[model samples]
Target: MSETISPAQFHRAPGVTDWRVTGTGPQAVFAARSLGEASGLVAPVVAAAERFGVRPDVDVRPEAVVVRVPPGPDGIPAAATDFAAAVSQAAHELGMTPDPSRVQSVGLYVAQHSAADARPFFVAALGYEELGDTDAVDPLRCGPQLAFNPITGDVPSRGRTHLDVFVPADQAPARVEAALAAGGRLVDDSYAPAWWSLASPENHGVDIASWTDTTD
Candidate 1:
């Protein structure tokens, strides 16, 4: 064969913050270095989360920051009317527009409380199967996966999780409203008619949405 050379792969800095844009797709993956950095990107995602009734969690690591876009039927569409608003807010907060070229795969996680009897309820109610358990680590689900762990006191300020709930989308709105009727208050009202978050009876919060795109 004739001598040929392939393009070299460029290795980016570990945890480099980036905004993922691919082929007019609906998902928007954001990467960053700190909570402060991710704040710039939070507004649009938060608004979308509220409209779609999903929660977008801020995946914070010492090395990098990640904002995983929630999926739809219940997920906010990549082209949401409020999308730009959210992004602009983040831009103001970050002091720069996030680099779109450095995007990476999204990360997902879940939490419960150490004191709560959540395992049985998760398995039976949410259809989450057990994966494994450790003394320190919470029980994990390998299929229809569930990441059950002790609540770390409180959710991060201006942050939430893109959780998967085993409920119908049409039913989500009513369920959420009922929770409110039962005295549950909204975490934020920025996004509506799409996703609305509410604190649960146990004070553990859940994002009620229409779809289940979790890695179960």
Candidate 2:
């Protein structure tokens, strides 16, 4: 297996300014003017991955082409930086620029005393694969990862399950503000730029986490 790299190292890699180390892996979004143009990027991205012998998940939309380096046990492979850089360079050749504002990912979290005990149920119910011992991931990777968060004493008032929204660091504050303006209340900001937990008007739980992909 190739060596694994830390998020910090990935961020510092050359030609990867367009990429971000998200909760799951290194990802980037290149903005395109049309669906045809976006689709044009798919082959080049796949070619880069083939050249590097790495797998990348690419999503083409009308306005953007997103490429994500699939992560391994420890983290993403060191070669992921090369893949990301190659993809970025190819997008640049097409007159596409990376859009940090559009780069984000989401995950589901379950608060419980025993993460292991609850793992099986979610795995069976959602048809997800076990990620290590206490987490589960969607096999198709189309859904958010579900992680079990341990709690000791009291159950959170918001509920047992919550959503963790991972956005670019620069876009985090505005995301929190918009949630609050839309009837959500700030439950906690003790973590500041790391994360801010909020409760919807109906008492659902969500955490805005922004610690990923930053240099601080």
Candidate 3:
């Protein structure tokens, strides 16, 4: 399992609902009815973040804008909360819904006989920068984080890698059902609420998970 960041470390302000903290920092996704709305959000959101002195990674999708606020020097948690608040207010004023529940982060897991030997190839191929020894992350924060897992024995016939999708706790059940409807087979669900491991029609593994304990 990857290292888990405690929920207490991700402080949320009063008006900022649905923002989540991951390995990256506090992240929120606002839903736009169309591409036009998504585009329209850029200027105001950027302006708001700048006003708060926070550098945010803003990804404009066809129907959403994914915002990731990086931890700051003074206090990462507080900074993240402030940044989220500003962005949330901007989004709400623009008729956008703070559907952070729909926000998801994916990480690519590559199982290798020797992680060191395999790491360089992926980093160079994807033009991804290294995040410590075992992971490579996209500098622009648009792509998924790549994690190298070392396997002891013979590699599996299916593949050496899989995808892990992290969603908000409340959305996991619906996500799992949708995956099943799409012909995905449940591999394991004993870890319920933490993660649900499933295999695609092609037998590729995809684990839908919640990074924080959201039972509360």
Give the root-mean-square deviation of each candidate in angstroms: 18.7, 2.4, 4.3
* lDDT digits (tens) for residues 174-199 of candidate 2: 99999999999999999888899999
Worst 10 residues of 2 by lDDT: 150-159
Which 10 residues in a row give candidate 1 its minimum summed lDDT? 4-13
Better of 1 and 2 by lDDT: 2
By TM-score, the better pick of 1 and 2 is 2
- TM-score per candidate, chains pooled: 0.29, 0.91, 0.82
Tens digits of per-residue lDDT for model 3 on 1-216? 222234454543465575875545667888888888888878876787777666788888888988876543232445556567777877888988878666777889888774235778888999999877688888877788898877767554433888988777668889999999999999999998789999999999999987542421
> What Cα-based lDDT does every candidate model obtain?
0.42, 0.86, 0.74
Ranking by lDDT: 2, 3, 1
Model 3 weakest lDDT span, ten residues long: 1-10
The local distance difference test score of model 3 is 0.74
TM-score of 1: 0.29
